[model samples]
Target: MPSHPSPPARSAVVVPYAPDAPPPQLAPLAGPDRPGGPAVPERWNAVDRSAHAPHLVAVPGADATEWIAAALVTARPGTSYLKIVDALGDVPAAVGAVLETARRRGLAQVKWEGWTTTAEEATALGFTPLRTPPGAEGPDSGYIRRLYGAEPAAPPYYAQTTHFTCGAVTALVARAHAGALPGEALDRDAELTLWRAATNFPACEPVGLGVAVHRAWPSAPVTVFLDTEDPVLLDHLPEAEQEWRAALQRLSRADAERSGTPVDPRRLSLPEIRAALDRGGHVLLLVSLATLQGFDVPHWILCHGTVPGAVVVDDPWAHAPAGDTWVDAHLLPVPDASLDAMSVLSPARFRGAVHIAPASTGP
Candidate 1:
C-alpha cells in the first residue's frame, strides 16, 4: 500500500471572537464541541481591548489537525498590539507568519505587550527591544517591532490610576494630545485633580467634563452633546443621592451655558465624530464598558481619529485580567457599529460626547 500523503501547511486565519459572548456571525457554532471549533483559552478571549483585536490568529500544523501557534491581536489605526493572554506552541517562530497576516490586514506594525514573554525572546524573533528607561512609554514589560518604517503618530498612553477616574483621565489625555498639557505631566495627581473638578461623585458626565475642560484651557473650543436633560451618571446611586446629583447636572448645564460652551441636546453620530477628528478636534465619548470589559458601568474614552472604516480611541482603563498595557489602550481602532452600540447607555438609552477644538498645536 502507498504511504498516506502529508497535509499541506495551513496559513494563519483571523477568527472573530468575543470574551463575553459570541458575535452574531458565528451564531450556530457553539463551543469547542463543534467540528474544527476554535481552541481559544479564556485568557486570550479579548472582549473589548479597543476595537481591532481580541481576534484569533490561528496557525495549524501541516496535518491541519493541531494548532502550531496562536495569539490574540488587538488592532490599532496602523498597528496591532498583542495581549499577554494566550500564546500556544512555537509562538516565537510564528512571528514571521503573524507579521505576514498583519500585513495582509493593512497593518504597518506589530508589538507584543509583554506578560511573561522576555526581551531576549522577542528580540530573537527580529523584534526591536522596547525596554524604555525608568519613566518612559516604551514597554517595560515586553517588546515591539515596526513592520513598515514609521506608523501614524498616536497620542501617548496614560493609564487611569483609580477605578473612578476614567472620565477625568480621558479629558486630560485629550488635553495632552492637543498640546495643552505635557505627556509627562499626566500623573495620578493630575488625574485626581481633574477628577475632583469633573466627577459627579463616582462618574463624570459630558457636560460637567466639558465645563472643566474650558476652565482648564479657555482657548480650547468645548462642545457637549447629550440627548437628555435628565440627571445621568446617577442611576447607580441611591434615589436621594440621585436627586442631588441630578441637581448638580442641571447646575453643570447652566454653568456650561453661562460660559458660552456649545451644548447640543442630541447624540453625536459616528460620521459627525469622524468629521470632528478631521477638523483636528478631540472628542470625549461616554460609553458602556460592558461590550469590551464585561463591566456594565458607564465609562468615558477619547476619540482621537479615524481609519478606513474604524474610529480611533484611547481607553484609559486597561483590562488587567487580559494582561493588557498601554499598547492595548492607545490608538485603538474600533469599528463604527461597535462604538455606536457602546455609546448608547442602557436604562437611559442616551448618548453623550464632548468635542474640544485644537487648543494648542505646540508641544
Candidate 2:
C-alpha cells in the first residue's frame, strides 16, 4: 500500500469491556467546565463513591481515553482504534461503551473490536479468524497478494485491479459527461474476479461498485453527448484500453457541436444532463472519488435540484448476509434489483460511473 503520513501517537490505557457485554451503569464525570457545570453528588451511585471516584469524576483531558473510545464505537468494524486514540487518547473502552449503548438503543451495525482468547475463537464473540493462505501469516495482510498477483495501493490499501476498477470508471464517466460515445463495455467480469480474490481486504466494496456502475449500460438504451470545445481529460485514463479513449473524444466533439457552445469540463448542469436523457439519451455520471463518498440521489438533490440523474441497478456481485456464505464471486450472481440498491459506493472511495436510463425506462 502507498505510505501515508505517519499517524499521530497513542496513549497507553485500556478501557474494560467485552463484546456483547452488558451496559455499564455510567455516572457522568464531574466537570465545572461542562455546559451546565459539574454533575451533583446526588447523581453519583455507590460505585461512583469509591477509590476510582476522584479519577472518574475528574474532567477529561483533550486526550481522554473515554472520549476516544466513545467516538470509535460509532465507526465501522476493523477501523484502527489505536489511530483514533493516537489522534485523541486512551479511550477504546469509553468508545466501546458508547457504541454498546447505541447498539442497545437499536444501532444494528455498531463498530467494536473483535477480541479473542483463543486464535480459533469465532461464534461466541462474532469474530472468526480467517485462515492464512499458503506462505502467509495472520488474517490482516496476506491471502490476496499471496494467492493472487494484485498489490494494494496507497492509504486505505486498495489493490491495483481495485484502483483500476474505480479509476477507469471515473475517467469514462467524465468522458461521457464531456459527451463521449458508447465504446467497448467495461470489463465487469474481470473486476468481480479480482474482488473475490481480495475478500476481507478493505475497499473491496468500492472497487466492485465502480465496476458495476461503469458497466451499467452494456447494450442498454443510453446515449452520451460531450462538449468538443474543451481539451480531452483522458490523460489519466488506463493505458490498457485504447478503444475506450477514441470513443470519448468522438462523443465530446459531437456534444459540443450539438449544443452550439462549449461544454464546461469542470461542471455539467443537472438540467442539461436530464434533458438529454429525457430524450432517450443515456447519462454518464462523472464525479470525483472524493465527491462520491456517501453520495446518493439525496445528496445530488441538495446540490443539483434533481435526483442523481443516474440509477445503477444491483447486478451480479458478492454479499455475505450470513457467516455461512463463503467469500467468492463465482457463487454470486448479477442481481435483478436496482443498481443503486446493490452497488453501494463506500464513502472511503467516492468516485465511479452511474448510467441514467431513459425517462420511460425506470422505477
Candidate 3:
C-alpha cells in the first residue's frame, strides 16, 4: 500500500493575540456544544480556543519546541509542540529536558528567551541554525519571530512536504510486511483505521483501549507470476500454513480445556488466528521457523496485494501448560527431561521449536 503523506511542518503557528483574545474556534471535533458532542475537536481547533490559546505555547513543555520544530522542517506538523504540551499537562521540567536533549543532539535551538542560543553557539552545539529574515511580520510571522528572530516568514509550510525521511519510511514499511500487521499500514493511517473500525468513531476521537500488533517476521518480497494469465503478487508468509495450523490446534486445545468448550482447530481461519495473537495482556507464544524451507513456511512471501517484500506471522500461543490432554500436533511437545534446559524464544522470533526456561534451572 502507498504510504501516508508526511504530516505537514509547522504543526502549530504562534499567532499573536492580545491576552483578551477571543477564544479561537474549537476544531468541530472539540466543541461540547457542537454536533460532534463532547468529543474534543481536531487539535488545531483546540489550540485556537484553549485557555492558553494566545500565548506562544510549545506543545506544553519546553522540550516540545525543538522536536516540534524539527518535525515541522521534516513535514510532520500534524501535532505541534504546544498542542502536545497541552495534552501532556504543560510540565515545564519535562519539556525543558526535551529541549536540552535536542540542543545536545544538535537537533534544534531556542531563540528570543534567555535560554536562546546564537548562530555560533548553535553551530558549536552541532545545529545548522536556521533563522527568519529580519523584521518580518504577520499572524504567522509571529511564530517565526519567537523561533529564529523577527525576519523573513519561516519556510513555507509546504517546504517540509518531502517523502517521509528514509529512516521513518523504512521502519514503518518493515513493520507492515511482517505479518505483525494485517498488512503494512502506516502508523498514522493504521491507528486511524483501528480507532474507526473498532469504535465506529473518527480517528481523532479517543478510544478507551489501545491495541497494537507486531508481526514476528520480516516482510517478504512480492513476486509477480507472469507465467499465469493473471499476475498475482505472490508474497511469502513467514510461517508455513501448517505451522499456523499447529499453532491454532495448540491454542484451541488449551482454550477448550480452560473454558470447558470445544473449539475445533480446523475451523479457525488465518485472520481469526492472527486477531487472537494480537490481543493485549496475554502472555504471547511465538514459534520461529527461521530456517524452515519454502513449502513448509517460506521465510518470505507476497503480502496483501501490495508491497514487494512483506513478512508474515500467524497465530501465536502461550507456553503455559493447559493440561496433559491439551498437547496438540501444532507444537513440538517439550520433553519433561529437557524442560529444565528450555528457553522461550523472543516474541519476534516465535517460529522456532523452543521451550520456556524454568526459573529454577541454573546455567
Q: For this target, which candidate reaches the highest lDDT against the unseen true structure?
A: 1
Compute the lDDT for candidate 3. 0.22
**How many backbone overlaps does candidate 1 show?**
2
TM-score of each: 0.73, 0.28, 0.18
The order of the candidates by lDDT, greatest first, is: 1, 2, 3
lDDT of 3 by residue, 1-363 (tens): 322111222224333333244224222213466332342223223333222222332232244433222110110111111211121122232234334433343331222111123444333322233323122121111110111112211111111011112112222232333323443244445434333332211111001111111111212221111111211111223345435434433443344244333222122223332333232111112112221211122111111110011112111111112110001111111221122112122222221111111113310
The lowest-lDDT stretch of 10 consecutive residues in candidate 3 is: 202-211
On lDDT, who's better, 1 or 2? 1
Q: 174-211 in candidate 1: lDDT tens per residue?
A: 88887789887888889899888887887888899888
- Per-residue CA lDDT of model 2 for 15-79, tens digit only, reads 43222331232223324543223222222221221211111211134645333322211111111
> What lDDT would candidate 1 get against the real structure?
0.69
TM-score of candidate 2 to 2 decimals: 0.28
lDDT on C-alpha atoms for all candidate structures: 0.69, 0.26, 0.22
